[model samples]
Target: MHNLNAIVVGAGMGGLTAGIALQQAGYTVELYDRVKQLRPAGAAISLWSNGVKVLNRLGLGKAVADIGGQMDRMAYYSSTGETLTEFSLQPLIQDVGQRPYPMARTDLQALLLNRFGAEHLRLDSTCVGIEQDEHSVTAIFEDGHRATGDVLIAADGTRSRLRSEVLGAPIERNYVGYVNWNGLVDAREDLAPKDSWVTYVGDHKRASIMPIGGDRFYFFFDVPLPKGTASQPDLYREELSQFFKGWASPVQLLIQRLDPQTTNRIEIHDIDPLPRLIRGRVALIGDAAHGTAPDLGQGGCQAMEDALVLTNYLQTTNISVEDALSRYQTARLDRVADIIKRARKRSDVTHGKNPETTKQWYANLKHEDGRDIMSAIAHTILSGPLN
Candidate 1:
């Protein structure tokens, strides 16, 4: 096992976690990312109990708890300041046996980078292509450097170059029909409850603020928009105001308090679940394998799940690496596919893709007691491999 080498492309959560797990299992690991400096793509990640369990398995539970926000409740609000429903998440925590940690993405990435050992990860090395034979696989970089190993992992993300290579065709990215603007802001009780994830909903749009580390809040605005909606610098606040006009006071405060310089305006998109996650010895993990809309807050969680599943399958030293990868896909493909589809459906509902469903959901929220929401989340957590 010590002689075996694993070449991992992309140093995102999934990639870094896999490298650490594989190294722990006695593989000499080669981790690479195309970026010159590693940074998270989003402001924060809502690490549900399932993801925290993965980090706990990797021995980073304490570190995560330290940086994580104190999110004990999820509350829904109408656009005009009326509370729709609110409930403590204690039952879900008890059901899942772990508390959810909604933390800043930068903090999580830095922790992972530190845990994975920064010296071992190769940065600014863009992996352009991959070559594999029955015995080995090679990752070819754009700079003519190549890393060959016993197995290759493609975790490069939604725009993964290696994903197209594995499928032997161009990958199609489907627009989820909404734009997301997300960033961090200094936490203020007037804007949102410091320990709660509060979302304001109406007119097929959402303005949400969730607690994050360091007394800051992770804020995001979602609106159904035509693809290719133009974004202008210095106008983000005005643009948001127009969209969320007449919303709650807190939503207004969030728009005013957040810094436009650090805010990210992104077109939300997700790839269809691939027909396969493995091609010979090269396996796709994370966004590279199954990119999904963020509606379920499980995008990063699923990637963490991928890291764990891949490592588990490869732990048995006697089995061929190919067989392990095959097993990994067999265990992961359907599960991830189900999640991706479910997330997409959620996006549709949240963004009013089907007006009737969205209307009904809004009506139902008035009488909701949070049982259904917690139950759905608990089901997702318990269905993971660790359970």
Candidate 2:
């Protein structure tokens, strides 16, 4: 076992995965979160092959498969109910050697917490500041308490307070000029194909539904809107109805069947790629380092990749801690930067911000087999460190 103790801030997917990987690597791990009760920040996460490979390495493969949705096909449709394209996911699944899991965020969080052991987690401990010396790093909390460790990892998310101190300035998040409302609803075959991940798109708007475990569907509605628009939770159903009005029957029915109480509404925002990801003995991971838009569905998957790669560096190298962290930064920076850029472009195209590009994409889908799409996805998955 390595004679090292590590402190991880935030109990999100990235932090929990980090804590788990480090613990398995023989580092004593301590985790803290700002929330009094642990809850998911979003409705669900699309755990692609790359992310699943990490989870399998962490010894959670069967458990994840049991709780994740079985997605067999993917289909895209026009808002008027015309089928734009449809394809089986088997080719991609066979290429990657694993199926993607669209698991509910809450279930995934619970699975991580259960595997990591709840006792190691400290809740309601909001981190306020961090300080490190030649030998150790200390995290200061809002409750006037402190914890010291061999290294500190700030997985405190996109609005990471520690990131500002590391970078010597506050970084602003760029809003993509849109809002996303998401939730889970009980699966009804009448509303959507229960075994397929389906998307309906038109008029700079999109609505998607994917099967999740527990006989339910995870759904999202995305539309262009001014930043900082207040979310009217009470009017969720009505608001969605208006935005998707006159769309296909599936969309109309899905909105009508949604329960407002279980829905979440928020403006989408992401940070510009940082020039660096480490400082002293502290390193940033996940959204703290490279928060990207969800258009690529790689945000959570990348975080999982970060945890595994960071752990691999620390375990395989005999170098100093600082050197290991610097290597991690070098290994991660460019890859995450590319993902951020791709996600932003995808967001623009999906939202109809570039009409010509959007039209071309829709047109191309008509004649193309699923080969190009699957190849792109396979490339992204194969590019990960584990593969």
Q: What are the TM-scores, per candidate, against the unseen true structure?
A: 0.98, 0.98
> All candidates' lDDT scores?
0.92, 0.90
Model 1 bad stretches (over 4 Å): none
Off by over 4 Å in 2: none
Model 1 lDDT tens row, 4-94: 7999999988998898888777789999999999988989999999999999999999999999999999999999989999999999999
Worst 10-residue lDDT window for candidate 1 reads 310-319
Q: How many residue pairs clash in each candidate?
A: 0, 0
Residue 117, candidate 2: Cα error in Å is 0.8
lDDT, candidate 1, equals: 0.92
Query: What TM-score number comes out for model 2?
Result: 0.98
